[model samples]
Target: VMGLIFAKLWSLFCNQEHKVIIVGLDNAGKTTILYQFLMNEVVHTSPTIGSNVEEIVVKNTHFLMWDIGGQESLRSSWNTYYSNTEFIILVVDSIDRERLAITKEELYRMLAHEDLRKAAVLIFANKQDMKGCMTAAEISKYLTLSSIKDHPWHIQSCCALTGEGLCQGLEWMTSRIGVR
Candidate 1:
């Protein structure tokens, strides 16, 4: 009975909630990463039309994550959901070197939005399992992350298929947001 009471009291005070959005070019594995977090397994995904909102608990903190569609036509609508975002996950297909310029452009545009100026940014360099994929450091340089000063940012190399580096990224995000 005493232990149960302590558990109840701990739950009352230990949970924190945060809002995060995952944005990137199409086929960057945002949905796969989301599934990995939610289901602990990979789920085959088609291109998202608008967005997928889901809640996940990491380190005892509840995170409401919005996985937004990254198609060129849908990119313009991303800002509409940024108003209350606390963290931004920008996934990049490390093997898609040809489209890095487009990714860079879209990323900078999102960062320029007033609502996200104070949000923590986590760049997931996805597809690291693919041959000749860029490393997280290279992606950061390609994206010119050094130029971003308004938000705390991190670049994590991740392979959604095998679930490598994903938790570290979330842990980094939670740390940046002061959750842990």
Candidate 2:
């Protein structure tokens, strides 16, 4: 088992890397969603400060996911990772109840960045298990990227608390990236 682990680690160090940048507004459950995707286990987490990275392989496609800090204060430093990103995952806490508009605006601004426009975008409408939360459709409507041509996007409803919708979202996202 240890040899297998070493072989995997060795291969990772020698492989060509594919990266995905995960961004969202503060307290949007971005970290939770990332933990679920990476660790496959629920974990207690506070807001991120700058960023954290997790290496994962799904169906032999290696992924380097950068979970960037969502706080307004930390967002100013996001530009450092804009290049070489193949995908962008934006998570929003559906039950947050007040920041939906702000989330949409922030995401729009990120998408508008010249270096990021070509990145495949995926929106995770998180906390879908909560009552009175917006649906994926509602979130997309507010994002207003509905008619953006030449770019691909998907809005997936997920409950990070229970892992519901996470696998589906990841599968959809990876499939899109594979074709890109």
Residue 69 miss distance in model 2 (angstroms): 0.7
Q: How accurate is candidate 1 locally (lDDT)?
A: 0.91
TM-score of 1: 0.91
Off by over 4 Å in 2: 1-16
Best by lDDT: 1
Q: Per-residue lDDT of 28-112 in model 2, one digit per residue for the tens?
A: 8877877888888888999899888998777776779999998888888887888988788899888875887878777777778
lDDT of 1 by residue, 108-144 (tens): 8888889987888899999999999999999999899
Clashes of 1: 0
Number of clashing pairs per prediction, in order: 0, 0
Which segments of model 1 are wrong by more than 4 Å? 1-13
Instruction: Provide the lowest-lDDT 10-residue window in model 1.
Output: 171-180
Model 2 residue 21 lDDT score:
89
